[model samples]
Target: MDMGGLQIEQDGQTLRILLSGVWGLPSAAGLDRRIAAIHAGGVRHAVIDTSGLERLDTAGAVLLHRLWRRLAAQGAKVEWPAPRPEYRTLFDYVADSGEGKVIRPPKESGALALVAWVGWLTLFFLREARRFIAFIGRVAESAAKVALQPRRLRLTSMVHHMEEAGLRAIPIVGLLSFLIGVVMAYQGADQLRRFGAEIFVVDLIGISVLRELGVLLTAILIAGRSGSAFTAQIGTMKVNEEIAAMRILGLDPVEILVLPRMFALILTMPLLTFYADIMGLFGGAIMAWSSLNIDLNLFAQRLQDAVSLKTFFVGLVKAPVFAALIGMVGCYEGLRVKQDAASVGRLTTRSVVQSIFLVIVVDALFSIMFSIMGI
Candidate 1:
């Protein structure tokens, strides 16, 4: 029931603050107001006498700490002459833990803030590019070593990742690719019907799906799924210091972790792409039959004429390259992860985004190269 209060008295150049009553949560509001009303502008020395305090808790301890800092900042040298044994530990904890510090926001940078931000971003990009190049070199060197001694390849880990990244991805990839095919056919038929060439919808679906969408969509799915998984798994290991332990024991973390996932993706991506192509074609053919009244035979026959071996191989060749990018980026970000749970999540998201972006870029480059080559 006792309200906390402080009485300040000044004598010449010195100030004294004597605290009394129950200094707890219930009295925190009154104490704060009272402290705020004090004027310590030019006092050279101040003594805080806590002997009159009837009770104290963490909340009151924090307020006392705040008051002490406020007076010090106002040009007064503050001192707590003799804190009681019961309050010493709490007061020491509050002071040492910086419970009274105020965090100020950064000053405004005005109109030039955008330019400064752009410059900082450019620098960050260049630095990350250098690190990525170095990471790729290390991966290539490790790959060459494994290629020389095939026995060093960890087949167990490779198989596990293959099942994870490839076999298990079949359902979602197949379903989505099939749906993409259906939508593409339906739209193509609607457009071609205007020109009295609904039958050409077969050519549209076959060439597009076999040559582009099937592999591209499948790679995107894998990047979001398997690529992010790689980052999270390895980042978590790094956070737990498991990666460091591997190095300490003379084991290569790159060889043991990165190479296996990389090789698994390289081996499985092409096969998954092929599966996606078949599923896509099947969906397109079904829609073609339903919408354009084209039978399975006619659809298949036209598909053969529209999509050649070159077309299929063109898309197929890009699968390994895309897989390598996804695997390398994912593992690279994972290895770069700092020792924290938050870093794992952040780097995992970065891995997925970077992998997808690089995949799309590489696909575009491939398209340009194939065009120039007249294939």
Candidate 2:
């Protein structure tokens, strides 16, 4: 039915409205109210029949847009036909979904979007990794030059590192390992004694200590001790501009600073682990002898029999890798410092954390790889 130059028709779920006379604020305002009423009545879907619209203006366009928005927001479906040339120009400012217009897409790019996002992330990760690799390569090259010309990496630094990683760590590593052994021995004894298999405590302590605990305990100790020390020393040097001074003097800081630490760490970590294994074994022996009444000689024999050179060497080999990783991480963090004391401290802590985390991750990788190799 026609009502004041506007035609309105309701067909089931659709309410079609048409504008005829010169469109203005009056037409838009009336439709806004009517759309609100329709929404209130839960008439969710409708078509606007603009077939009769003539001489539409800004107000006419705003009125149509307002109804379109209200219908959309109320979960009402609305389809307005391709506007007549006269009316279409008025709604040209409409963009995006909130314009209260129904747009049917010819195609969707959801899959393509996901692929692009994932590809970007992958490239980002690879770029970061490549940067790290490049950094390592530069450090190594600088170190090689220093080694060739300056004659660094002498016995003194190596000896000192051995003293620190091995001799200095011995007491704590030994004590901890011994205690771990003792606990293992007691636990094994309590259960094994029932089956007259108390001797297996020796095997348990030997295998566990040699293969896993010794390496792990040693790594944790060094991470706490040497890892932090590496970071702090390099960080302090960095903060003091000593590293920059070396660079100015044409001295490769990596060789003078980092290479020594690398040598020291690689030199001592295995020794520390070896010492730890011994200590853990001794502790286990003590527990076995005291709690299980197992013969010390028998425990030693069982330990020797149960722990193979292969297993012992495995832990030994892993220690150098752990040390290298720790040193790398520590040096990386230290180098990142921009001379701030707070940043130095923060970087030191991060170095230790990252070192320990990488040690575990590398350990897991080693375990999996070795298992595959039947090690």
Candidate 3:
């Protein structure tokens, strides 16, 4: 029967599709309806005959591919006759594309589905953990090599990343720390005033900020800021196929891209933590003087007497470790990005989340170790 620009004939269990005239964009709507209406029931085999076609463009090729898939889905084996060279190329290109094809897992329900989901999640987590460890090993190896041959290190890139991740982050980090200190002092003063120990707020702010909050908060902020930036930056490069090009050119992505950002964060995190500590104390001092009626001079003396070198160093020591975690997770997720804008966006968000989670977990482990050692 004639169906617009094509004809369909059934002989026994075999179905044949015949094409003629123009099958380009103009006739696409009619072609779709006619192709969809073809009777494939009880048919075991189908063949596409393209010899009668006068013209076929990309849109036509796509529609033809769709028809092939539709017939196959109905349990009929679809075959295409060899057409012109140009037709073959267009058909192959359209068929090979991943856009229109979707692979979905079989559906399950009830307890079995829950169990399967849990199993899948467990496997996913374990796989991700393995990859992270492997990435860390690669970074360590590259870092050792760079250390031995200092000339190979990208000092200019390191400094540039430092300015980007460190210098630019100061205002927000300092502002947040200062606000936290003010809130801490205000709350601590209010609580302690009932027992006539409003002056002890100095010790509270000094110990809490220096021993924990300063570095912890700074690392968290950096994870959300610079960590996401690293992912988006590298992810975009991957989407553009720049990383593959770099590999072809014999350039190490780890050395050129990862190390500079990681080392920059490592060097700058401690400085940022120190600055955070200072701003935190200054804010506490201000609050103490204004709310608790404690003199600024007395506040300074109390802060000096309360927090020791060990307390300050305790927080500083965690900075590099947190920085490494953040930078590595970001770059790792970025490198894992697929060649699409959606993958870039998805992995950038995942990088920030993973970096923050890892930072907190490591911080807790450090806290336990420090406590056990009585530091």
TM of each candidate vs. truth: 0.75, 0.64, 0.73
Model 2 off-target regions past 4 Å? 1-131, 146-150, 194-196
Q: How far is 160's C-alpha from truth in model 2 (Å)?
A: 3.4
**Rank order (by lDDT, best first):** 1, 3, 2
Give the winner by lDDT: 1 or 2. 1
* TM-score of model number 1: 0.75
**Model 1: per-residue lDDT, tens digit, 1-375?**
668889988998999999998899998898898888888969999999999999889999999988888898899998888789879888888889879567678886776788898899999989998999999999999999999999989999999999999999999999999999999999999999999999899989988998999899999999999999999999999999999999999999999999999999999999999999999999999999999999999999998888899999999999999999999999999999998899999999999999999999999999999999998
**lDDT, candidate 2, 131-221, per-residue tens:** 6577678767866776687755556776776677668888888888888998898898899989998778788888888899999989988
How do the candidates rank by TM-score, highest first? 1, 3, 2
lDDT of 2 at 149: 72
Clashing pairs in 3: none
lDDT of 1: 0.93
lDDT of each: 0.93, 0.78, 0.93
Per TM-score, the best of the predicted structures is: 1
Cα lDDT of model 3 by residue, 183-260, tens digit: 999999999999999989999999999999999999999999999999999999999999999999999999999999
Q: Which is the winner by TM-score between candidate 1 and candidate 3? A: 1
